[model samples]
Target chain A: MTATTPREATAPAKSTRGFLRDNALSLFFGLLFLLALGGQAAAGWADLNNRLHTDGFPPMPFGRYMTSADFAVDVAENWQSEYLQFFLYIVATIYLIQRGSSESKDPGKEGRESDEEQLIGAYAKPGSPAWARIGGWRTALYSRSLGLVMGILFLLSWLAQSIAGRAAFNADQLRQREDPVSWLSYVSSADFWNRSLQNWQSELLAVASMAILAIYLRERGSPESKPVGAPHDATGSES
Target chain B: MSNRLLAVPLCALALCAVTLSGCGAARGPQDAAVVAATHFAAAVSQHDGAAACGLLGEAPRTELEKSAGKPCAQAITGEDLPGLGRIAKVETWGEQAQVRGSSDTVFLSHLTGHWLVMAAGCTPRPGDPYDCIVTGG
Candidate 1:
């Protein structure tokens, strides 16, 4: 005998604890970022004071040094370059071809295509974010927004670096009893270019190493690489 | 996203405000010149006698050697420094007064301190050029 009964429909209750637990990685990263920033500040302060003492000037107060453009520029320039590397790498991976590298999408997948493939527009799942469902302009922009924002940040931080670098260089010049250069002149000076190029060369080398490394390197259950048993030529989604 | 973008301009404005406030009072021409001389004296006071010796007025240094029968630098000491204070005492004669000890005062004319200007505001004195000459001691 078949029995028929009315089924009750109820939404699952969302627990705050579960949400916090799920997002623990993000919280951990945020704390790590703050800690690293503090470390940079402390180390940079000591470095500046050392230079001052060597130059025969009284050591500037730590609080005053913190407000100086020299520290700001040193920090910002490094930051901008890092963001630039990631932004360029992120966008380039979409369109550029790099054979046998896990960082690249397959050569043929050059551009955004098919709502179903991207899970956007009508193909977006019921629980997808509004941006994916909204379609048209919102979806189009949201698709590339990560790279776009990073690129913008790179430019802004680079500008900040230039401004701050000018001040720091000027201070050094004053101490050395040399005529201070203008902002434009400083941008072209060996001091500015050397500091910039040294940082940039390291970043580019690291990026290149990462992209090429993923071709053969594998970590089990990691999205950054294919499965341990996967062939070296395997590309696209790791899972 | 737009709100976040707004932060750029706001940050720029704040930076400008801070910079404006931070723009230190640029040493005036007279102060600039005096600071130059005092900087030299400070170097001398630090026992860098060679550097201080380089800052002496050639004429006065030569005069002292001829009159005292010794190198002008041998006559100066940190104890004899008088004008090494941060506030440079400029004589009405447009000379920057540099101290050798607490009492001995040497007024340095423009670039007269010789090698003291070697590294831009550096004034080379013969000895403890910065120390105010001790009157009794």
Candidate 2:
């Protein structure tokens, strides 16, 4: 019988099974996202048809409803808010501290710590990313890449929400025999702010709830929560 | 593999956005709306009540008949519909449109791929729906 070395045992197996296992979390969530989106489309189409019938309009085809401004706006509004939530949480965590939350850093460990602490430039190990090892502008940009990407996605989806929202709003306006407002006018209108603020409030609330809840809660096997045996005062400790 | 998976959805979202934005800006829908508005206005001006009634949406047609206690042909001409002049502006937003003529405005809905007038002789009300002389119930 061959004895397995610690390094060999610790290293992931080079196989399809290993790949699937490694990516299981992301893959699982991706599948849920597609299924949920499909469900939303189907439900939204039916609801829209009901409204159309009530208003004496003909039922819209499924394909047409999928491509409509109403659907686009609905999807974009939620997407923008989600990205905004992640962007805010990521950037805020660097400066903000929670005394007893697993989601936060130890109170004294706040702010962008030293380059050594981050393993950048001279402090970077051999296995560190190329940008971290190389340092300079690449390192600086790479350091903020996660937050930057989230913020960019938020902005893009928010812009999309505005465009699609205006189109949907104008369609409703025409239904009521009202004039369609200009893009600038639409952006400044209550309809735009309402859609944005509603989603924003919910996302903010959920994030706030998670941050505070993690301080008192324990989920044994979850990385998001502290180990069950971990003290209630423990901060940033995951299972 | 993970990168490719991410790229696929991102590409799909981009494509969806492009398709949606394209739909909003298309000239075909605008032209169709304009044509419907023009036909309705022309029929009204010519005192061809039947032709004008035919262009109206089902609800507006039924409402006109119910309120007037007469057939759509006789009832539409009796309403205070203005003689709309040349088509001045057209705005279409997914299955609905608003067309403004030199003298009046017309609202239309695209039903089963055909533009039908929902309301005519509409005047803007401050912070309220347009006060339409003819509207769907």
Candidate 3:
């Protein structure tokens, strides 16, 4: 073998070949989503057909049902809540401090620190990302960019859910020979609120469970938790 | 040859490939409106009272009595309504349609098709099958 060269040692490595090697959970969940979605579609369509037959209405085609507001709202509401969970978690992590929980920054390291602590301003090395070295509005923007993007995405998804939910609800009204609701009215209605709250409750529960469980739990190589050998008292930085 | 000269043909070829790969059939507003209407109609026909009520506008379901007139009734086990079988026809124009039943023609419009009710009294009244909010025969 050739002598160990400094250049070879210092050079940054390239990304891994496949998602399975890089992000196994992402790939797994993606497949799971498709499978779950297919099951939901089948079950929803069947349920819908049964009701139609009882009410003197025509059963819809399977493909056609896929485009229904019911399907869209159901999917969108769940997606919105999930994204909202992530968004809230991201933003909360920035300022909040937890004493012993793995999900939070250490109490000692609470609040925004100095430029050197953040590796921005004068402490930035030669090869730092451009935003880190800029040290002005750019740096300020970059610092909060993650939360900002997450918040915006959460809002957009929530809006999408509302729009789709309203449409689905309105379809029901028409069936009973009732007038349709406006988008604004739908947003405030019990129908929209019910869907939103149900999804929000589940998402909050999952996030809370993760935060609390991470305090003592160990998941081998998972970054979401501390290393198995790490002390239960350890906070923030994972081993 | 310069890269620019080659890029033009490459871009055109890429566009053609994308279209061939089924990325071009974007659903228009009209199509979306029809789908919305159909979804509404289907929801109500299924006897999903709650879902049908959700599809109505404030003007239509504002009064409790009015809402009660076309209420949805939950079907009994195994018993099916003849009209609720297979979808015989779906013709959409913007956000309205004249759904022809074996016996009667029902007027369907976006948000006005699905009106789920605890009773059969809450179903909304479509002014007339032929004279809907948007005109369609």
Candidate with maximal lDDT: 2
Candidate 1 C-alpha RMSD relative to the actual structure: 11.9
Ten-residue region with minimum lDDT total, candidate 1 chain B? B128-137
Q: On DockQ, who's better, 1 or 2?
A: 2
Per-residue lDDT tens digits for candidate 1, residues B1-137, read 24265347435633642352224323343365565566556655676655556665454444445655766466434324434444534321111222222322333434423222322223434432222231100
> What lDDT tens digits, residue by residue, belong to model 1 across residues A1-239?
66544332222224556766888877787679779878987888899879765654445666766676666776777877887898888887767866677777776787765779889888999898899899889988988888888887777767667667766765564444333456688779888788788888999999888788888888787777777887887766532
DockQ for the candidate 3 complex? 0.05
lDDT of 2 by residue, A1-239 (tens): 99999778767565657988889998899789989999999999999899888888888899998888888888888988988999999999999977778899887888999999899999999899999989789999999988887787787778778778888888887776777887789889999999999999999999999999998888889989988888778888432
Q: Give the alpha carbon lDDT tens digit for every residue of A9-107 in model 3.
A: 655443334534677766777679889989998998898779655644557778767766566666667767876897888877778866567788877
lDDT (Cα, 0-100) at B88 in candidate 1: 32
Docking class of 3: incorrect
Identify the superior model by lDDT, candidate 1 or candidate 2.
2
Model 3 chain A worst lDDT run, 10 consecutive residues: A11-20
Candidate 3 residue-wise lDDT, B25-114, digit = tens: 234433454444445456655766465446444333334323344332322111132232333443332233334344323444443344
lDDT (CA) per prediction: 0.59, 0.84, 0.57
- The whole-model C-alpha lDDT of candidate 3 against the native structure comes to 0.57
The regions of model 2 sitting more than 4 angstroms off are A1-14, A237-239, B1-23
Clash number for candidate 2: 0
Of 1 and 3, the candidate ahead on TM-score is: 1
